[model samples]
Structures are given as C-alpha cells and as structure tokens.
Target: MTAIPVSAITIVGLGPGSMDDLTLEARRVLAQAAHDKQTVYFRTIIHPTVEPLKQDLPELRIESFDRLYDESDDWSSLYQQIATEVCDLALQHPIVYVVPGHPLVGETSVQLVLEQARKRGITTRIVSGLSFIEPVCNLLALDPFEVGAQIIDATNLAISHIDEVAGKIIPTIPLMIVQVYNRRLASEVKLALGECYPDEWPVKLVRAAGVGEEEAVLEMPLYELDRNNFANHLSTLYVPPVPELSALRLPETLRYITMRLRREPDGCPWDRQQTHDSLKRYVIEETYEVVEALEENDMDKLAEELGDLLLQVYLHSEVARQADEFTLGDVYEHVNAKLIRRHPHVFGTVEVDNSSQVVQNWEAIKKQERASAGVDVHNESVLDRVPQATPALMVAQEYQKRVIKTGFEFTSLQDVYAKLEEELEEIKQAASPEEQLEEIGDLLFMVAKLAGFLKVDAEEALRLANRKFRRRFQTMESLAREEERPLTSYSRPEWEKLWARAKEAIASN
Candidate 1:
C-alpha cells in the first residue's frame, strides 16, 4: 500500500448506502488511516453503510459532523466552517473526509473542502464511488439521457427566482432533485415548481435508494409533496417531464413553433414567402388591434390581441434569422441590455427624485451610448429618434415634445390657443389648392402641439372622437329606419332633429 501523503486531504465517497458498495481503493485508504492511527471524518454518519463500515474496520477512529448540523444556523456557512476545519486539520497531518456517494455529487461540504484546500495550496485526492443517482434511476427504470433528465440540488430548486423558473425547472425534461432532507425544504421546492407546474402534475419520492429492503418509492401528485413525512436525509424527488403539448406555456415553445412554421418543404407556403418588409403592415395592424382591445377594456381580447402582436414580432424575427441578419435572442439581449444600461437609478448607484429625473438620466445615457458607438451625437437631432412610420398625430406630438425641451414652444396656454387659431384661419383663407393643403397640414400639426401642452395623447383623443362619430351615425341610421325614411332623403331640418335625438339617446344610454 502507498503511504498517505503528509499535509494532504483525501476525500472518499462511500457508495450509496450499503457495505458491499465500498470500492477497494476506499477500503484500503480507510485501513491505512486506521493503521496510521489517524481519525477519519464523516460528513455525516446518517447512512446505513456507516455502521457496517465501522464494524468492518474496528480499529479506525471515527469523527462525524452530525453535531455541526444541529449547531450551525446557516447550512452554507456551516459547510464552509466544516471545510475550514478539514483544511486546518490537513495542515497538521493527512486527513480523510468521507462523504455519501461521490465527493462531487450532491455533497456541498466536500466541494467546499476541495475549494478551500486548493486555496490553501494543500494537496488533495478524490476516491470515486457510486452516487445516489444510479440507484434512484434504477428504481424509476428510465435512462437519464433518454429522458433528458436534469439533476439539481433541492435548495437551489427551492429558492429559484420565480421569474426565471422556466429556465431553472424545464417542464419538458425529467428532473431529479437531491437532498430533500426535510419537510420545509420539500415545501419550498414545491412552491417554486408551482410557478410553472400544475398541482396535478405527477412526481415521485424515493427514500433510502440502494439500501436493499429499506428502499421505497412513493408516487404522488405534486401538490402533496410536502404533505407526506417520508422525507429523510437519503430522500430524492423525481419530477417526470410534462407532456410536450402542455409545454406551450414556455417561451421556447413559441420559438419552436415559429421556426417550424418557416421550415423548408413542409412549412406554410404563405409564411415561407413572407419577408421583413412584407410583415411590417401586419405588425402595425396587430398593434392597433391591441390598442383597440385596451381602449375597449376587454382583458381577454387584450390578451388575444397581444398574442397576435407577438406573432408578428416572431414572424419578422424568423425572417431576419433566415437571412442571418440577427435572431430573436439578439433582439431580447439588445433590449434587456439597453433597459439595464439606461435605468441607472434602478440598476446602478445613481439616484433620482422622480420619473422626470429618470427620463433626464435616460436621455443622457442614450447620448453617451450613441457617442460610444461612433454616432454623430453632436449633429443628431432629438426628433430623429421618433419613427416616421408612426401615426401622423403621434409623430407630430413627439416632434413637438422634443422641440419644447429646447424652449421652442409657446410660453403659455393662451399663446398655444392663439397659434392654433392662427393656423385654423390660415387654412380657411388659403387662396390656392396647394396653399390650402399646406395650411391644413399646419393646422393639424398645431392641434397636435396643443394636445401635448394639455397633457393628452393626440392619437387616443382622435380615436375616441372617431369612435363617437361612428356610434352616433349608426344611431341616426337606426332612427331613420324607425321613421321609415331613407337616410339620404332626410331634409336639413329633419337631419338636425335626427342628430339631436341620436345624441340624446347615446347620452342616456
């Protein structure tokens, strides 16, 4: 047998819960430690294999960190402390740290010890053994690779960010969560998974795997995960993959659907023929439908319309992806980065008093970004950021808002009204058709500017006006039908009376 190195840490893996599972190298190392009168440290002596190993090696001195578990407040810090103590002991003499299963698998203290030992410049060695994953997988009778299984620590799955839960616990893959050592941890894990998985989703609890007759597997719905008392230090939770059709809630599902719709030969012919330029009008139309849903205050309609708008975005992105210009991932990355970079008060140490200050900071950061990107910041107009393809009223309002920041706006409401009236009169007094068109355009521009000063959305106001006119005209048609007279045959007096009646009926309703 090779003599143990001085001032080194040897971590041994005690194969999952059976005396016969011990590897020859691990047994030799333990015998050597016993012969050398060195104490072997067990991360925890809570496994069925511990007693059998102790019986086999009667002369071996054993020390367990079971007391540390009861004494320490924080598990992370406790693991670090255990690592520190092991490294400190290695500095005095060679130390053996025996952990359940593989030192690298589900053993936090073992990992911590390895890291701390490396930092302290201490020589370290690992003795591999069968991890709990093998026996658990055997009991389930499924190949991990075939099922696209993912293994994660219970603690990580428990405290996973709710918003990022999709990326953490994918529903389309089988999940094996280790170290569900207590009811509390199981409960937290259940809540985290509840974000994406339904309560009726089936899952399994396996206890004392590879421990012969002591092993048990309990199949239950996800909602009952924390309701049972079968959890122990040797327990693992298995979450089967959700059905492929049920994975529609995932963003990747949308991406996949979009890509499949554009796939060659079998793809939708119309979708295959679409280009970015051809899809622009669809995007605009879907956006208006979303606005219409919002204006009507129908949440269900809003959700459906928003999905249509999202489809347009996906279609355009797929087109760009086919051309190899950029991808949906690039779009997300660019926008997410821009949001974080511009919102200094939220993401950085910069302070602000209100949203006004936030807007100021946003513009300043944008200017800095433009300068860094070699854009002509000094020569660029503020109005250049507003898209020309936007609705005419919105474009006009945006232009006015931008220019007003430079003190080019009217000083007061009276001045704004005066300018509006001036433009209106000029349109009426125009001498030629060309002059009349120019004056009318100026009048509408002035109206949009007036809307900005009055703190109203010009586009929404115009939409509301258009809706009111349509509703009142339809009411007039109804009134005309009731009186048995054609709408076109109504005299001026009769038309005035019908309009008044329609306005009153709508107001009463």
Candidate 2:
C-alpha cells in the first residue's frame, strides 16, 4: 500500500587494498552518497580504504559494527544482526552499504541486507570493484582457470554443507579458501578439507594477497595450516588439488541422478513409476549379486554391484522425499549419528579390547537406543528382530543367534546332532502329510542352527549349495543327451550311474 524503496539501496565494494583498487563507478557513488543525508555503513573499517574514504567525504555519517565481531563467535548470527540493523536504518533513511570485496563474493552481510531490502520492495544495486581474487592472480602470476582454482568461505561451513555444495572438495583442482581471518577459522577450514585432502598434502597460505609487494605466500603441509606468524583478515589458504584424485564426494552426483530420474515432464517411465515397495525386490537382488561378486573375489564386478546397491538407497530416499517423510540428508544423518553413538571407542572415550567386544558394545548401544525411543526391549521376544520377510534360512539362523545370546541354546554340537537325528526319525515316522511337513521344517531349522553354531551364514551357504546342485544336474542331463538316451527310457540305476559320471566330470574339470 506504500511506496517501494527499490531505489534506496546501494552496495559498493571498497576494492582489494584501498582507493587505488576501487572502481571509478564505486568512487562516483561514494562521492554522491557523502552529502546526500543517507546512512553510510561499512561492513568493517579495518581495511585501509575505510578511513581514507571517510576523510575524503567528511559530511558522510559512517557507521561500523566491529564490536559484533569481537562479541560473537557465530558469524551467521552476527551477519543476521548486521542485516537487521541495516534494514532498520534503511527504513528511516537511504543506505549506502560498503564491503571489502564484491558484494556477492563471500559477503554474508551484503547478501542478508540485499534479501531484507528486496522483501521490502527495495531496489538494490551493486557497484562492483576489485575483489581479492583479481589482485591474487596478479600477485601469484597464476591463471585460475589453468589451475581449476575454486574459492571457499571459511565462515559458512557446517555439517549440512559437507557434500551438498562447494564443501565437497574435489582434489583435482586447486582451491582458494578465503576469509580465514584467524587461527580458529583456519583450523575449521583445515578439518573440513581434511576429509578429502590428505593430512600431509602441501597447501599455501597467502597473506595480504594483492595488497602489494608486502604480500607473502607460505607453503606447508595441510596439517600445519594457520601456524604462521601472520594470519588475519587478509589471509587465504590455497589448497592445490591432489593430482591423482578427480572427485571427492558422491552425494552431489547421486542427488543429481535422483533428480534427473524424477524430473517433471521428461523422466524414465520405469523410474518415475517405481515406489519403495516396487523397488524392494531389486534391492534384495542387487544385494545378492554384490555377495556373489565378493565371494568370487571379483573386484570389478563388486564395485559395479555396490554402485547398484547404493543407487537403491538414493531411490528409496527420493521416494521418501516425494512422500515428505525424509530426505537423503536425513538418511545420512541417521546412519552417521548411529555410527558415532554406537562406536564410542572411536568418537567418544569408551574403550574396547577386540571386535567381539565391539559387537557386544554395539548391541548394548542398540538396546539403549531402542529404550530411549520408548521400546520395551525387556518384554520383546528374542525373535523380534528376525524379520519374517528374510529368507527362511537366514531367519532361522538369526533366531538361533538371538536365543543363544539370551542363554537358551543347545548345550553342545552333539546335542544339536541329536536333535537333528530325532527330527529325521520323526520325518520317517510321520503319521500324516502335515506331520511330515512339520518334521521336514524342523530338520531344515536344525541344519540352520548347526550353520549358526559353525559361524556360517546359512542363507549364503544354501545359495551356494543350490548353485552346485544345478551345475551337477545340468551336466548329468548333458551326458544323457550325448548317450542319446531319453530320461523316459532310462532306469533309476542308469540315472544314478549318470549322476556319478557327472560328479566325476566336475571333479576332473
């Protein structure tokens, strides 16, 4: 209902060093703003150009928030406070906001101010000047594109930014980490980068870059970053990419694939139609294939199959997103938190002796997690987690392990054998088909228990057995064809002989 203040906001950069690097357009605007009765705001007056400009324009009422920097550890909150203050002042009078670099480059306050001003229908204009990068290139005699150099802001990093954006450091290119104003900020940058770049990798610390001949470029290992005598507002850490490594993180790529497959109007028909329920079978199938690859010691196939399995994770997360249930980040966070919580030996102060002890600790942590979530673990059955949807053999094996953990297991392997024999005899003496079925079931479950006691994965062992049987039966059939004897014409004795021959052939092969 009121007039929009679009013409009231002006953002100007003070250039890299001082007035010498300031743009002509920026200079002109500052001169006009000096006597216009407008509120002048400097992001900080620490830069050499600030006092010089104030001296040139004595009529300008200059304000600075250097106190906020001294008082707050949170840069984001500090920037928010500055933005609010600027907006409040702009509401009363026009604002000529000045920052050290280009308004959009590593200028959080500038962005926040622009956002607030836009919400009030204010028109904002950016008067460009030389950013640090310009002087840096000249000072170092380096071409940014040739080196694939990228810039990162030290103040904006968080766990949420790890792989979603520029935080995913690809070591194939050189990185220009800016705004490392102190040892603390430098340490944060070093840790965030340490995820991809090796600890001993060499990185450069360029102080007062582009300011003049006084600029210094210090080279040292990444671990020794921020250890220099001179590191302040003018400091920047340069991380040269590792030559052999190309990419660092996979989330961005996985997110891109998921987005493309689910994009509106033009996406894969099969992918678009798939839901979590529809993709469950593929997840199970891909898992088995991965197991097969691992068992066969096929590294190439294993890598490919693992990618297929990870794709299923992305697909499920995408489905969750569409349903407003969760996002990929939630999936990552859940697993990451669980890992850190359960592995107190790694992330916390708890200690362990062996992997067996680690497993015990993991199970205890799981119980605590369940109880925290209001689950009645004490009242829950031992078989509560032996999922019925899993393969019968695995379910039996899981049940056995659970019961054994609860001290309800067979006394010895001999007891297990005795139970197996009793079940077999019951199968032989079954009074009805239903009774025979029960006995057969008991026999298979006993075998599974034996497998568990022997530390074998019953499901995988059964699958291998099935594969071996199929191969031997196929060989027997092939031999029958070679003899030109139809199965209808072969006697039971002839079939037995052929089976023996097949076994012999396999052993010879």
Candidate 3:
C-alpha cells in the first residue's frame, strides 16, 4: 500500500452571498487549487456564492460533513469530530476548505481545524473574505466601530454571560447575536437577556443577510421573542440598547398574594387547616430565608424568599380576618400608617439626623400612641414589653438592650464578663440538677447580653459558632477515618489532637 503524500491545508473564505463579495485572494486560491488538481472542500455549499460556483467547478468536492452535524445531538462534539476529520484529510492530500464569509470570523470549525493542523506540523493558510457582519452592517447602515458591536453565538447564551455583556458593552451600542437557530434557543436567549434588559426591549431578527430572497427584518419586544416564528440557522438576533431597570417587585408581590389565595379555605386542605400557632415556625423559617438571601446577595432568591415571608404575613392577616379582627388589607393599612407615623422626618415636620435618633423618636411616638389607644404603658421592668414568643436568646438580648438604654446595666464589657463568670461558678456550685440548670440559663442570658453590648445579634452569632463547631468536628471525624479509627473509639486526648489538626487545617485554608 502506498502512503499518500501529506498536503498543505488552505482555508478559503467564500464571502457573503455574491461572487462580488469574495476577496481577490480567496478567488485566486480557489482557482489555483482547481488548476493544481487539488481537492476543494466546502464547509457548507448552502451559501448563495458557493451555490453558483458549483456549476463552474463540477469536480469541486464539497465537504458535506452536514451528516456529522446532523447525526450528533451535541453541537460541540460534532464540531470537534468535524475538525478532526478535516485535519486528518489535510494530512493525506492538498485540500482547499471553503467556508461562508471570513473563515476567521465566527467559524469555530475553521479555528479547530487550524489549531489541530498546527499541532500535527501541517502547514495551513487562511484566505480572508468579506464577513456577513460587514454586509449586515451595510444593510442596516450601521458603523461597526463608531456605534460599537458585540458578536455573540446565540447557542452560548447564559444568564451570567448575558449579564457580563450588558455590563461591559455600552448601552448606546448595538449587539449582533448570530446562530439563533430555533424557537427554544431563542426563548432561552430572551430569558438570559430579560435579566439585564426590559421585557419590552426592542429586538430585530434578521435572516439570510445579502441573499436575494432574504426575508425582511422582523421586529418584536424581548419578552415576545418566542412568539416570532421565523428564527433559523442563518438568522441573527439584533438587540438595540436598553436603559430602563426591569421592574421586579410587582410580579413578586402578585405571586405572594396568589399563593395565599391558593392556600385559603376553598383551596389546599393542608393550608386551610393551618392557624397562627401552627404556622408560627413557618414565619421564623421565612425570616431566616430572607436573611440568607440578603447575606448571599441573591436578588432572585431574595425576591422569592421575600414572597414566602410576605405569605406568612398575609397568612396571619387572613386568620385574623376569619376571626373578624383584621383583613389582609387592614394589616397593610396599619403597617403603612405605622411606617409613615414613625418616620416623622419623612411624613411630618420632625427633623432627625441619623437612624438612632429616628428610632428614639419612633419609640417615643409608639409609647404615646399605645397610651392613647388604651394600651398599658406603665411597664416597670426592662423585660416587661419583650414578646414571650421571641426566641430566648433574642428576648434576653432585647431585655439587656432596654436596661442599658435606661443606664441601669453593667458599666463595661469587663462587668458583663465578670457576671458570666459568676454565673458559671454558681452552676459549678449547684447542689442539684435543677439548680444547675437554672444557673446555666443565667449564664446563657449573661452571654447573650454581652453579645448584644458588642453589637452582635446573639441568635445569629450562636448559629454561626454552632456551624463552625460542626464543620470542625466533621473534619476531625474524617481524619479519624483516615487513621482507620472510629470517632466514638477515640480517647479524649486523641480526639483533641485531631480537633486541633482540624482547626489548624481550617485556619490555613
């Protein structure tokens, strides 16, 4: 068997649609390759320019690796296979690979082939031709440089990528997105874009640019992208710059209200049976979710969790409405009025410099209002007003904060620390389990007070410490497993060694 001599790879750019659009260099290379009896391959002969050339060059072996693309479900895998095959063919014989427009522009297959050929020590030449971008720009009367343009593959649309493009690209500049292909892909593209651009943002869908039977430009709002039925492989999505901030609150509020209605007496049985007492834990859970959302800086999750939290409020309000106490509307009206009343600086003539002063003013106004409403105002103890339903740590912290405000608390951090130490000593000296438990509670209360004085939320501080301890202990357990020992079988001294190692590892990280 005779081994075929390896041939140089020539990438020819067919330019857009017409032969007039083809560069002199691209035409020269194609003609020369034909004259030399070299095999000519078209990446895609579907282009109008390449369609006419088929007649002049009957022997031009067009690369219809379309079957490779058609057979593979994954485009990336197909592209890789196509590039590999082209490079293998180039290694065997001199080949002229023809691609639509500039081979260097938006041609991933050409890029792959060139890269693979380079690795195989195969000589490769790229003949540049007029790209579809230039022709599209001409058709739209757009200046690519002056207006600025971003060319993105439609298939690669993702929320984060769209956000990055929106952030970097100036809003005044137009964006040209190529290879939209289908409605599902178009919808995905729209959803990604919807995060940055408004739902009503104008987008132009252009198909078959520079071709004679080219369809007229179709216009639609960004939200109605899927509604446009003319999207295809040769289509491009053009998005004009948007300046408006997307309204995110209204839909969230609607969702909250709808969920509550769905769970009403005439709705879900589980939800209908729920009362204020039964749903108490849900309120606390939703509040924590809101805190988590805020901590994570996740606006979408925050919006969702906030809706859950709102549902709790509306749930309680609906229960109250059943008992003829208050309706959901009444709950809103009360809170809205309370906020306006409390922020006298905003709703009234009262002037306040900072948040602290505003809080003080609010408390003062609340005391006066409670007295007028025939509510008790002669609360003697600092802890008297604290809600019994609140978590023990939070209640203790609130009691301490109230006492400190009245200048009837510990003088300094040292004083609070000494009190905690005293409680610990009492716990150690306790004669019975009941006495010990009481002392331990006292100790915890003092610790919560100290945490409050330090401007730390006692509940959250404890929760974080609990999480850290669990993580460290888990690491210790894993280390024990590595040592072929169970955590339960380890002695105190051995456990301490592993725990220390875990802490050290955590600190190092």
Candidate 4:
C-alpha cells in the first residue's frame, strides 16, 4: 500500500444504505477518520446509514454533497466539479470519501476522483463495500456467475446504441440493469431492449434492495416497465435468460455458421478458398440481385436476395477475421457510431423541418467529424468516397450529386442540356480517335447529370432501353423465321418491314 500521509485520501462505500451490509474494514476506516478528526465527506447523506454513522461517530464532521445534485443541471459537469473538489481537499488533509455503493462499480465521481488524484500525485486508498448487485442477486435467488449475468447502467442503455451484441446484451444470459433513475429512462431502456427482446417478456424491477425502507420487487411485462411510479436512483432491472434459442438471441449463430464453413478441415473447398478479393464478385452480384428484387416489387424475392447479400457480408468479414484484419463487431460499430453522430435530429436535441435539412445537417456533421479527426476534408475531392467499382452511370450521377453540395453544379436541367449539346458538337468535330473518345465520355456524363436532374435512375433507364431493344430484335427474328427466311438473309427493306411490325406489336400490347 502507498504510505498514508496528511494528504492521503481513503475512499469508502456505505453499502446500499444498510448498516449490516457495511463491511468491517469500511466501518473501521470511518471510525478512525472520526477519532483522528479527519475530514469525512459523503457524496450524499440520503442513505439509511447516515444517521446511524452520525450516532456511532459523534466526533465525525461528515460533509455531504446532496445539494449539488439539485444545484447542477449537467450530471457530467457536476461529477467533474466534485472530483476537483475532492482532490483539492485531499491535498490539505487526510480524508475519507464515502458514497452509497462500491466506489468502483457505477460511481462516475469515484472514477473521476481517481483520475484527478493520480494526475496531481495524491495517494489514494480503496475500502470496498457491498454494492447493490449483491442484494439484487439474493433477491433473484440466482448466482450471477452461474447464470452468466451481464450488468449494465441504464443511463448508457438509454442514450447510446449498442453495436457489440444483440438485444444490447449477451444472449443466453441474465442481465442486470442498474441506475434507472426515472420513468423516462426506464421507458427508453425498454424501447432499446425491445429491439432484441419481446415486448411481452417478463422483467423484474427491484428498488431499494437491502434497505430498511420497503424494498419493492415487481414482475411485469417489459412493455409496462414505465407504467408504475416506482423508479428511483436505487432502482434496477433484471432480465431473465431466454428459455429457447432464437434468431434474436444471438448474432453468434451467423458467426458460428461462418466459422464451421472455413474452420472445419472437411469444409467445402469453395468456401475455404475464398479471400476478400475472391469474394468481391459475389458481393457485387448479390447487391444487384437485391436491387433487382426491389425493382420488381417482390417482397419474397427481396427477402431471399437480402439473405444472400448478408451471406456475402459474413463471408468477407470471416475472411478478414481469419487474416487478423478485423472482427464483424468492428464493422457494425463503425456504422452505428456514424448513424448516431450524423442524425442529431434523432439521437440528440437538434430539430429539423424536412429530409432536405437532415441531408444538409448530415453533411455538416460529417465535415465536423472529419475536422475533429485532424482531416482536411475541404482539400479532398468531393467525389472521393464514391467507390470506383460502382456502375459508371451510377458513379456519374453521384459525382453530380456531390459536386452540387459543393456549390459547383448546374442549377437546372437547361444548363445540363446545354452542356450535353456542346459535348455532342465537340465529339462530332474531333479529328483524333482519342479526342472523340474523350468527348463521347463527356457527353454521356452530361446525359447522366440531366437524368439525375429529372429525378430518374440513369443506370436503370439504360437497362430498360437495353431490354426493349432485345425484345424487339427477338420478335423481328421470329417474324423472319415464320416467313421461311433467315434474319441475315433479309434485305434492308424486308428487315425494316419486320422491325416496324415488331414495334407495332409491342405498342399494341
């Protein structure tokens, strides 16, 4: 242990407000601090043991910060200021810092105190006490270790999106949610958890566990968590382990499937041989199929195509994981963080009028994020993130879309049409093949920008034109065959007659 000095600080927990729950060492530290006339400060004096401690240590001058909770609007800043005060007071005298539960568990102030104290070269000591988790386990009649319990703070569950696991928790395990300080927070927790757990699933709410004042334990459907008015600082939630396996239970099922395909010695050779580069074609293929299903307006086909697309993701991710590049969790974390950070209208207090404003705000947020990461994004090309592998027509449209955001695009389709006409004239006047090629490409790009201005999908438009031509030509060939003449044997006049009839046939249909 570090040598105790006049500047040393001893931190203790009051053990969930029950006198019997306080450990012997914690009590001894309080007694010694009182006997020596050292400063003893309680983070809050609202605990049941506060009066008992006052009677036991009559000489102790215990200061309380209960009023700070009411005085400060921001809990983060409040905890920060308290930590500064604790470190400053410790420098002048040996002190005892007491809080309601174990100092290391869910106490933000204690963490800040340790960080500040360490930076100032102050000696610190910890005397652990019983935390609310112990009594909660007792009430549940279950061993946390045996049940594979996962404990989380309700505050974190309320504000942040969970990306590492399903249901915001590990599956096949019990979960203990602590620090549910109000009904609003309880409702938020229930909503976030509802993504992974059924709304009708039973959940237990425990309040003031091991305290003298009545401990309330209520079992209700998860949907009703915010209905009753039993929430307080001491409230906690218990989610029992799922009885049967489910898709929502774990994402690990997909991970396991991928693992067996690649890890087993007798696995399919095609799967075992796939690398990131080798699987790229399948990723692109599956994505286009999904798009095709959407274009056809078929939900059944869309679902099957979506699964195939997911398979591509799992295969590529597993390949990278095997190569020690990254895990699948890293993929979702990147996207989840981007979603929360970009959509301030949802996750934060920012308000907006329409989707247009949301798009502008998203770009602004992305720029700010880049600046924070020490990137000079203003110097980078506006089309830098558009993938090279994307379809050429789609890429062209995206280029025009992004450039418009930078205030450097045609204001209307009239300007796009003018550019297209100018490029077509340039292509016709070109002497060299290279010059003609360059001008032709420019003309196509202008065409794509015009399509974008008209709110049309340039790529899909080209696909439809290609389909129409193929269908007409096939009909022409069939007419030639019916007339006992090969399509190649037809004269220009005969071919024209067949093509006109084919067009008339399709137009009539």
Candidate 2, residue 238: Cα displacement in angstroms equals: 12
Q: Which of candidates 1 and 2 reaches a greater lDDT? A: 1
What does the lDDT come to for candidate 4? Answer: 0.83
The weakest ten consecutive residues by lDDT in model 4 span 1-10
**Candidate 4 Cα outliers beyond 4 Å, as residue runs:** 1-7, 36-39, 71-78, 91-93, 161-168, 212-216, 243-253, 256-282, 289-308, 315-509
Q: TM-score: which candidate is best? A: 1
- Tens-digit lDDT track of model 4 for 261-296: 898587678899999888889899999999889977
Taking every candidate in turn, the Cα RMSD to the unseen true structure, in Å, is 4.9, 14.0, 19.9, 10.4
lDDT of each model, Cα atoms only?
0.87, 0.80, 0.75, 0.83
Candidate 3 per-residue lDDT over residues 1-509, each given as its tens digit: 22333248878788767777778777667666555666677765566786667676665555566576457666446557878888888778777788877888777778889889889988988888888787777667788788678777665553245546455434445788876766776887887776656788888888778775674578888888888677875677888864322323333344345455655456667766778899999999999889878866899999889989987887787777767887778876888999998888998898888999988998899889988989778864556768898889988888877877788777788998889899999998999999988999999998898888789999988878887998898888778889898888988898788889999988988
For model 2, the superposed segments whose C-alpha errors exceed 4 Å read 1-132, 136-149, 152-249, 477-491
- For model 4, what is the error of residue 288's alpha carbon versus the real structure, in angstroms, after optimal superposition? 1.5
Top model number, lDDT:
1
Tell me which residue pairs clash in candidate 1.
none
In terms of lDDT, the poorest run of 10 residues in model 1 is 69-78
Q: Write the per-residue lDDT of candidate 1 for residues 415-455, one digit (tens) a residue.
A: 99999899989988999999999999999998898899999
Alpha-carbon RMSD, candidate 2: 14.0
Per residue, candidate 2 scores C-alpha lDDT tens digits across 1-509 of 22223346788888876568889888777777665645678878777777777787787777888788788777558778988887877777677888887888777788889888888776678888788887776766779888878777767652224554444565667788777777876776777776677789888888776666668888899888856555677777777766442343545666777877987769788888899899999999999899889978999999899999999999999989988999999999999999999999999999888999999999899999889999999898877766687889888888888788778988899998999999999999999999999999999999999898888988888888988999899998899899898867888898898889999999999
Candidate 4 steric clashes: 0
